[model samples]
Target: METLVKLFKNNIRQYGMIIALVVIMILFEMITGGLLLKPINITNLILQNSYILVLAIGMVLVIITGHIDLSVGSIAAFVGAVAAIMMVDLHWHPVVAVIASLVVGALIGAWQGFWVAYVKIPAFIVTLAGMLLFRGLTMIVLKGQSIAPFPNGFQKISSGFIPDFGSAGTNIVAVLAGILFTVIYIVNELRDRRAQKKYNFEVVSGGLFILKLVVIAAIINAFTFMLAIYAGLPNILILLLVLIIIYSFVMNKTVMGRHIYALGGNEKAADLSGVKTKKVTFWVFVNMGVLAAISGLIFAARLNAATPRAGTNFELDAIAASFIGGASATGGIGTVFGAIIGGLVMGVLNNGMSLIGLGVDWQQGIKGLVLLAAVAFDIYNKKKVTFLK
Candidate 1:
């Protein structure tokens, strides 16, 4: 039936990334002799990718505002160095060092934000200069040395997991969290359907909606199960989940989120409609900077050290993730979930290749090819959709 064909076509756009994730996971499992999805490896995959996923949240917002931030990696490294200097050299408490690092990162964002917003400079140039400056700062702060032996609590920032507080045979926290996720998914989808009906718009059919609920429930519970096997889910993983939920809510439910899309969709017109273009631009960069800093802390905590070279090339991974997740290079099109998934794709490829004992050269070559192909696919998909419309 024509209705079935049309439904399938529409659903494809919304579900393509999920489909791709499933397909790639299966293919990689086969390639790795079924090791890719092993419970331990799956848990590790999320842990290792958590930092980039955090950065991608900010990067997607930056890309949405029609700009780029090449300084995130450098900023991350610089922040880590700052924290290390505070904790190691100054003998400051680890908690104080963490807070100071985040504050420093926020101020760094404010600095770049000022240049891009008030000074009317293109983001590319400002962030590029920032990239060099921050990297140099990191080197100077670290004195070209790696610093380690952070306090146990500091290491726990990334390495620790929520302690189980339930029955001996059952992990209560994971079970409760899984239940919450299922409830939230169902409520959110129902709300979306109601809103669409109220607005006289076409909504996805009930069958498809139920299918989505089932798929989401399965994935969330499955992830929770894996975490229970590991150290019961990392603190960093919990942070990532909180961010994903909060930002996903912002992007979907808030007026500010709509403003971002509007500005991206058409900057000139949005300005004409009274959107404070400069404020939005400044805030986006500031937020990006703050996130870069947090990501830096996570990266440092994971390694339990700080180095001038930490987070090198991380900006590349974040950008590639955004592009692959369906963000147009020119801006005005992207999603938070899309960017996260994009990061995972890159993370998985890197992790899986390393597991299989692939050399760095081959990893770089293949990843570069994957990035190129992903960008090309984004372009092709847009063109196809436009033609269909």
Candidate 2:
């Protein structure tokens, strides 16, 4: 009983945001008259939120490193414009255009990183200037007009669905993927538990572990089944999954990842310990630029156009997602999965409210409240922990 209690408390502290997400989803699902989880709506939700998820992934890293980038929205807009020009007007190959856009993104990152990391300019000021500069450049690039109707190849990046090879009315690929994911998840959990035990670290009891596995498996299979029924997997979904897996591994298992956390936790102490704070900070922004660019391409492809106002306020969305996902504003705290959950929380709220005929004004107001509550919760938890210690 004591072990179970301890496990529950630990899991709550670590996964409270995820639990809140699930609860909010269920509430919205009920309020939406069963429309929230319909197969088509589920697909729409994933597509609509894919670009934000991309940005959130990168933003979490920035927050984890104890900095902020207010220019991501502008950068995304600029990159999208560049892509549109390269592919539409210049007639560059889709593949080559993508490469060029990514290169542009990296250069943008390096530019801001130079100011932030090397020149010792505050990130807030640098990114603020970048926001204005890039937004202006986007307008100039597009000449205050929208570019449209990208090639089919480019559109497919955001709108394509996976081929279905299953029997009529079923998606065999999705089911298989779900099963594989469940197995991998269980195996990883068990392996982690064994490793922790070997190192004499605390671990949940066997029964609790089994329960956790079962619950997660059910959720995974259910989500996959919903997707299978609608249109199988989306191309953007695949991209999001790959990124989540790769970044999760990087953040949780890599030496660079640990160093980033250390840097965020205490910059001066990290420097004293021989951590290259400047290089890490520089690379972190560079990575953020690349992600913002990828998001730009995805967004432009989804809209089939690049407008001057493309990516307006996207930085706010990404930042909110990070904080809602349990990323500490003080840095050195967050997870890739948490960011995904945070994005989903916001996505579902938007979808559900829209379905129920809520106006955009109300939606924005509600979202603002939710963001405040999440940050307040984080601060409360931190204070409680400190008091207890």
Backbone collisions counted per model: 0, 0
Encode model 2's per-residue lDDT on 201-298: one tens digit a residue. Answer: 98777887888899999999999999988778899999999999999999889988988999899999999999999999999999999999999999
Clashing pairs in 2: none
lDDT of 2 at 108: 95
**Residue lDDT tens for model 1, 266-373:** 989989999898888888888898899999999998899998789999999999888877787877888899999888888888888887899999999988988897
List TM-score per model, in order. Answer: 0.94, 0.97
lDDT (Cα atoms) of all candidates against the true structure: 0.85, 0.92
Q: Which candidate is the best by lDDT?
A: 2
Best by TM-score: 2
User: In model 1, which regions exceed 4 Å deviation?
Assistant: 1-14, 166-170, 385-389
Output the lDDT of residue 303, model 1: 91
